[model samples]
Target: MSEDWTRLSAAIRTARKARGWTQHQLAEKAGIGFSTVQRLEGGAPFTRRPPSLDRIERALGWQLGSADAVLAGGDPEPTGSVDAAAPREAGDIGAPPAKRLPRRIEHELASGEVLDTEVLQLGNSRVRMIIVATFEPGDGDDQEAVAEDLEAWTRVQHQLRNMTPSEGNP
Candidate 1:
């Protein structure tokens, strides 16, 4: 088991170096902590639960079972899921396929109060809208409640986005 771990560690180090990625860069790309990457690459023993193999594979642009193969001292194989030949920045590895943007729309009512609406957009589609705040004189609505509701709604939208298929036909 130790030998397998050692081989896996070496393979990880080699793949990271081949891509000109530092430990910190790998951590960021893999969505893992810097110390996790350090510990793995440092061969700190397989005594504890390791980082997610899926995350490491995604970060290194390797096939799904590549980690297992490397651990068994075999060659890594391409999954052909992502274009390995294409140049990718560290920021692009674990980033969401769609970009998110929050847009604020405010209007001054006839009563001199401002009605503020915030819309969260994922890529070109608007995913969520919240009445962020009502800036009115003598208004005492709990702003914290509004924030909490918005947060919960945002989480739901994110989950929906993940569950939905990216390809329209598929």
Candidate 2:
């Protein structure tokens, strides 16, 4: 099906302006090149990647696939019902502020175990994550076993990040 690049471009521009962000700022937040965002906003013909579009959509606080929907002549759905026209506060950039980065984040596994991780932003478009600790429910932990499990889990996350869209996700 043909896509309306014009519509997608306008929608992206509107969202970026609504957030009081320049093309460079959006590019940084989306982890994409400045030219990509500029070309997209200018309605210039260019090859599109799913990951790039997904990042741009996420950076704009739009739901995943919002860009594709807009290109198809439909409205982009806002993530968490955010109003694009809402006024932005001073220094309230679209991306999370550096000081607001989580020092620690915990996730509970379906098996009732807990995984602790720390996520660090190394620089633009580069992030490092460390598994701090893992807790098994109601049992003494083995240090060796915990290390192995964390290593295996990290490898899986790496695989997922590198997988193409057609591969889908487990």
Candidate 3:
């Protein structure tokens, strides 16, 4: 096996173990398939569009460029010793913190309402909204009730869409 591959695989294994996470947990946290985690931990050849090293780094909470260095045959310093109290470098003073993607927001329509909405932020500036409403079964099937429910759902969807900022705006 190539030295770089072996080093990278070992680093991944060590980092996962340090967090007391199983392969399945790591895969879930990384938003990747369990089998992919297995292959990576098993040191299988990284073929067929392997997951991005950046994704794995984010999932593992390692400092940026740590995985890249391992894959490039360089030893990376452990991330646990980062000196938060240290002064920032001159060039990095104004650098913004990295944004974590794929956030989720959930809220209810009213204090006691059975309707709830969840917003999932997909990467690359895309988002999906899901609305859920619950109702107790009626005495019998009621067409009018069904139609009312549909109308309420449609109105909620429209309101949510309008609340979202337009693409043209910042």
- Candidate number with greatest TM-score: 2
Pairs of residues clashing in candidate 1:
none
The superposed Cα distance between candidate 2 and the true structure at residue 72, in angstroms, equals: 0.5
Please provide, for model 2 over 126-153, each residue's C-alpha lDDT reduced to its tens digit, 9 standing for 90 to 100: 4454444455654676787777787887
Q: What digit string (tens of lDDT, one per residue) describes model 1 on residues 1-170?
A: 33477777888899889888788777776766678788788765675445355667766777766877777678777655532334346656445322322111222334345444455445555344343434445456587865775687677656654654367732
Candidate 3, superposed: residue stretches over 4 Å from native: 1-3, 47-49, 77-170
Q: Give the TM-score of candidate 3.
A: 0.42
Model 1 residue runs over 4 Å out of place are: 1-3, 48-51, 80-170
Instruction: Write the residue-wise lDDT of candidate 3 on 41-87 in tens digits.
Output: 77665643253455566667666567667777876655563222233
> Per-residue error at 51 for model 2, in Å?
3.0
Worst 10 residues of 3 by lDDT: 102-111
Q: Return the clash pairs for model 2, or none.
A: none
